[model samples]
Target: MELSQEELRKKFTDLSQNPFQQTKFSRNTKIRKIIKEFANFSQEKLRLENKAVKIAGRIINRIRRFGELTFADLADQSGVVQLKVVRNKDFARVSSGDIIGITGKICKTDLQEEKNKQELSIEIEEFIVLAKCQQTLPDTAHYKLKDTEERFRKRYLDLLVNTENRDILITRHKIIQSIRQFLDQKEFIEIETPILVSEASGAQAKPFITRHNKLHRDFHLRIATEIPLKKLLVGGFEKVYEIGRIFRNEGIDARHNPEFTTIEVYQAYENSEHMMNLTEKLLHYLAKEILKKEEFEFNSHNISLKENFRKMSMIAAIKEHINLDFSQVNNLEQALELAKKHNLRLEKFQKSIGQVILAFFEEYVEKKLVQPTFIYDYPIEVSPLAKNKAENKDIADRFELYIGGLEFANGYSELNDPIEQKKRFEEQTKQKELGNEEIASFDKEFLEALEYGMPPAGGLGIGIDRLIMLFTEQNSIKEVIAFPQLKSKTEEK
Candidate 1:
């Protein structure tokens, strides 16, 4: 039952008072440490040693069988361990959801029906309530809450009760750690880029705008960590990477979030092929390091992270998926006719044949890519920051890594020509003027940086949250995110 505020205060006031005037418990060991220390120790060895230890964790479960003895499970972040406590007035009052400190000696417990079987346990000598639980938790501990919103709203409670949720978060952390370690080992320097910019450009997405009263100017939360990281490339860094948050004024869906995390990596003197190969290698390494295997299961699909991922051009994937010959789409009118043939809608600003090709792919081909595939040679109109192919000016030297029917990574052969870059920005400006909300702005400073002569480079961006979702077999991006944005409950009707 949920306790009232006054009742909770009274319970806490009583808990705060110490009758014995004893010193508060100081934790010298964790429950996980205790388990690890005695994991290999036998019953005879534990009895002979009688190791005294101080451990701290939350009381997750309580079993009352004998009149004088109680068995409660104590859980820390690492794992849970069994605690055997002798019943007393204070001990009997201890309930689940209470943070506790215990000083105990290690021993082995032998239950009935198994005379020779014994398990390691802690025999409590001193116990104190480190923190008392005031409000009651959800009734179900092992089961999920019926309201999915509650899971994200009260993540602490979710983590406390659901081991699977905690494991997904832990896996997310390890994936990021592995990324940093992998980049560092590969001689890539990690760098920090600005989160707020005068103009949000880099990817074709609307930005969250904010104003600064002191400066009397507006700033946009970064849409992607792309332009600033490229500025580092212009400043002569061979390889640099940043894993940061990006905000987008866009829709929220199963795979997308208003605010998300991505890692943008740039390597000087590299091409699109180099970035694709690096992407393949990095994910392969992450699979082995994080999952302890070369394969993982997601949505009933057993994905293999082994070598030799399939590579296909954007037009080829379109053809393979729907038998559409996009290579013949050389002009806007022809492309529109083909799109109309396929019943795919096109925006007014998407007047180029390349844009129409992209529209067809998004509508008909993207979901068909169920395995690890690199869809390369994108339409130049869709990839503003990428270098154009020398042989075909209509297509950019770019690729997007797709796995489990979701785009995980995007990359390109960097465009360093200032003149060409300005022209591309002007084209985007025209599109934005034509009511294309998902278009990048013209960053004059980024253009100026290009004039200083950046070398031919490769750049890649991976949505860290989406990758975590895939690794943890979570379908919604919210499941991997600890605290996702939700509509306000206090809004007026």
Candidate 2:
């Protein structure tokens, strides 16, 4: 007889009120430990010893009765173990995906199937349902969610069904913990910065704004932790770093997210060269020491951290890629001709020679950086916070780390001169007036801090999600992020 949907719900609810109960595991052992400790023990040995153990996990397989003996697979965070129950009356009502506590003895299964050929298992003496699985689950044979959109929408279900997803999140935790340990060992102080700010003056990104009812003011979610952290440099913190959320009103793609995490580190009395070395050491530590990995597959490129990274100037990189060196181009008219030759589209604010060089670099050079490469001496128009080179003010002492053709980290020698910084801010303001919405804000407070005499420093920022994507060998930013923003189902339809 076919039971209706409501009937099935009622039946499950009634069966969920089972009397077999334990408040918590007083002496529970992990299945991983058990398997490793008793792999040699046979069924005869386990029966003779009769040493009992208690374990609790979610059921991964439906209970099956063969010749009055019941069996199922139970899985915890550690691993999975097979469960055997004999003559348990309540066992009939137990379902797959239910959380259960079992008092059992370790043994090896002697089932007829060769697949169960003396596999280590446990014989249950008593069991209780901790939680019932109300909804149906995907098949346990190869438990997996079918739709990619649904997997992101219901992350719990995805995590339950996919072991890889669970491992990725676990690796995320370990990587962060290892980073904290690494930085702390280097005498770097981790500081907390405010999420809401009066100015979004950090990077070239649109800011998310919110209204404050009580203060009768508008505030922007911080696009970067650059300003406040640099303020700490003025306050005499020699080494400071911030690992927190950053908000940017930006487009979402495989490599980009609207909301993401970044770690910005600033060290006084250091130059961009020192920060570049630090960036390399940090990534090496993460790959070799922490993750026990020397190579990564990201964006179809096999990147090795063991090799010394390549360094090239931005103009040099563009020249190497397309054989067009901009060093000889002396003025704006020549740059405009080159831009027209390359079919480069330019906005009103992008008409300057430096901006045109940047447009050429983006068009010709960026994607060719497959391995770990640092493109330094960026055009001044694109690097507002970086110090200008003494020889030529057209370029700044800025470097961006690229791996797998993706931008991973950025570092630069800090511009300590308040007057020069104000000039840069004025330039940005002029660009904004000329129809560039992503220009850095003229942060009066940050300028005030710079005026109070900040020491010369080096600063670096890493996109945490992109770093994890490389470490985890995942291609999409969404795979590494726990919950990426998604369109609503109604909107999707």
Candidate 3:
């Protein structure tokens, strides 16, 4: 049975005047009314219309009337609006999480105060029940979404009722947009690379493995966007970049996601110095465009883009921050002893001098880099794809940008020498054989690409998630990622 407009108005008037004591008006109602008034329509015209509107979405909130007006708000990807039932009979039957079509007048009312003046609002006139909610919503105000496990499981709800959370994800899109615009203006062609590869040849990160039944071969999810993007450089593309997902079978934390987005770019005829400048400019532009400010806060630390970034070699950084000269610590054994002196953890067996120094830097030097700094001239053992510095045979022409104690960007003057590249890949293979799990595997195809006479190019890789986190002032990467991986609730007993 359908109630007429007069009856509905009477019901609403009755509920508004002498509503049940237990029922209180929602805070959003005033805002809705303000929107209605701003739309400039009367309540009568906004009243229930006979036509059925094809409305669709998840039910955000529900009202059940025992002695008061009750209803629920439905939200789709488009937007959100409120639903109400002033009559007790209609309200008693409806529940939250119901999908429904609402037909009503687009009315206006002065419900919300803005700038010392009451403002008009908008709302759905009358709603038809589509699907009823079965389970009760978790307490959303205080007890809601505190558990990391549950939050990921109920990501939809987390996005709802949390505007700040939604904004973080929206900001990520803007960050990507800014990068695309920046690169496109610089004539860098955007490209897509295969996600599943015969061999992963980029970063020293564990790959997620899968077996292809038809091919009867094992394949790995690409660990980095480095190899293929560089192959384009060999093919004579002057500039190229890929903003895409890379998979790594790694531990999860506030900083790390198993699958994450990275932007890898390469420019022919440029070196590490050019890459450093590009890194600074790109990041500064992203911060300015996406955040609309050159300064922001992250982890209680204020970061400014007004000044040029501090640049220091890895050895120089160790000397300045650790007070231990890398010149004095000449070998792996001495470096390991120094690490132990600083109470830094490392494998008991033989490790390369590069690994020992890196472990020491991670422990002692990285945290002290609270501002934007370019830590360059990395040890050749760790940077296999980077060219060796001409003056220092031990250090590669690589630089990593750090801000707020998080590594944001890494770039290098690429190793274009096919023979030297082969030797470096072999070293990586040797390291892998020695039980270092995160070592890059030898890729014959990538070496073949280099052998085809690749140009001297500069390349960079920036962790998109971490960059978004910093710009949005979010403490956790999950906040900026819309559907970050969560432990499956079904797996829980």
Candidate 4:
């Protein structure tokens, strides 16, 4: 039976004890033992009224006596169960949200009106006040976790009340496990890299600034695992992957988080084409193993893993989707006019051909890409770390895998020339000076590692959170993450 805060406090006061004191008993462990014992006893049709110990959890709700027995709903992490309390026996001791345990018989009830046909019931014979609740709980029937900020602040409460929210996070764990198993089968060794770095390099993303108290120097959080993972390749590890957190000081959205998990894998002596095949197989395998099906729906779109994914060049996609000829729209002015025609938002400083192309793709092509598609051969200006295509010098050997209108993974043939890397870094430095915060910074150590003769390799990164969201059929990234970032209460106006 559940007890209310007021009832528990009154009981504690009557017993000459404080209700808010912490206890050493772990509820989760005790509950599991109780479940096991009950399951065993139920197999033999044994009455558990006297044998069962006081099982305690927060009271969910209470219903008046119907016919002969009074019903109370109680819940813990394991699951919810109905409790039948006999009338005229210290019933005032129980209230909503109070922690109480009832020693009762384990019986089944025919819940004809409810969704579940069979319901577990406890015929209460005795009870104990475990701990008194001090605060009143909000009404859970019409629960309002509307404020995204508060949802993060009280994630434990949110998970306790919402089963779907809990399920999403559990699905994320399964997806990550499937990913590790898939890579392990492909002979990939998992490795770790430093989060604190003297110089942040690898991708064109801004880093979170931090200070060292003892060293009296400023450092940046590693924005990407690209450079270190490549260094592992140079160190003679044929296949390696790192599933770790990467920090980027950027805007927050459904697809973007300031701190997120990224899986970076590098295969030595392979090109982007090989990585594409590996990417497809790994994702398909994860879907099959984790979800136990190759077909699923995302936002009304039917996706099938059995069908071959569409592969298209960036220019080809733009021409086909936007109905514009990229051959004529080669300059910034022409590109900006096309972006305006498509109603894609473009900043004044972003008036470049590459930036405009990206804007156009985001507005038109991305939403239309319902199935798995690899849009490859990106413009060289935006792909500094990728190798240039042999046949097309203007484009790089980079491909982004999109499914259900969301980019799932990105892969490229890694650029290994030290001189060319240095030149690209210089160009990025110039862009940084122009107030482009996402430009990659020059890392002398990375350049030095490149000069040490790294092998030809293909690298890929998958957003683990987003992939989990896809499999779980959740629309928001926050739904999959157990605890996402939120602004402090003090920051609110």
How many backbone clashes can be found in candidate 2?
0
Worst 10 residues of 3 by lDDT: 19-28
Clashes of each: 0, 0, 16, 3
Instruction: Estimate, for each residue in 336-395, the C-alpha lDDT of model 1 and write its tens digit.
Output: 888787788888898888888888888888877878999999999889999999999988
Better of 2 and 3 by lDDT: 2
Candidate 2: tens digits of C-alpha lDDT, residues 1-493: 4457897677556664543344565546898998888878867887797878998889885667887788899999988989877887678788787788889888878766675468788888887777767677666676678798899999888888887898998888888888888899999999999999999988989999999999999999999999999999999899999999999998888898899999999999999999999999999999976669787677888888889999999888988999888888989999999888889888999978889988888777788899899999888888999998889888899999999888999999999998999999998999999999998789999988999999999999999999889899998888888999887899889
Give me the runs in candidate 1 sitting further than 4 Å from their true place: 16-25, 39-44, 63-65, 112-116, 139-143, 490-493
* Stretches of candidate 3 exceeding 4 Å from the true structure: 1-94, 106-120, 123-126, 138-143, 331-333, 348-350, 487-493
Residue-wise C-alpha lDDT for candidate 3, range 1-493, written one tens digit per residue: 4457786556444332322232322122333333434344445454543222334455554452335544455565445555444553644444455454544433333333444332222244454454444456543334456677676767877776565677778778888998999999999999999999999779989889999999999999999989988889888788999999999999888999899999999999999999999999998898778778888899779999879999998888988987888877777778778877888888632387887778778878998898899999788888999999999888899999999988999999999998998898887777777787888778899988888888999999999999988898888988888888865566665
Query: Which regions in candidate 2 have their CA more than 4 angstroms from the true location?
Result: 1-23
Worst 10 residues of 1 by lDDT: 14-23
lDDT against the true structure, per candidate, is: 0.86, 0.87, 0.76, 0.79
TM-score of predicted model 3?
Answer: 0.82
**lDDT per residue (tens digit) for residues 170-189 in model 4:** 77888888889999988899
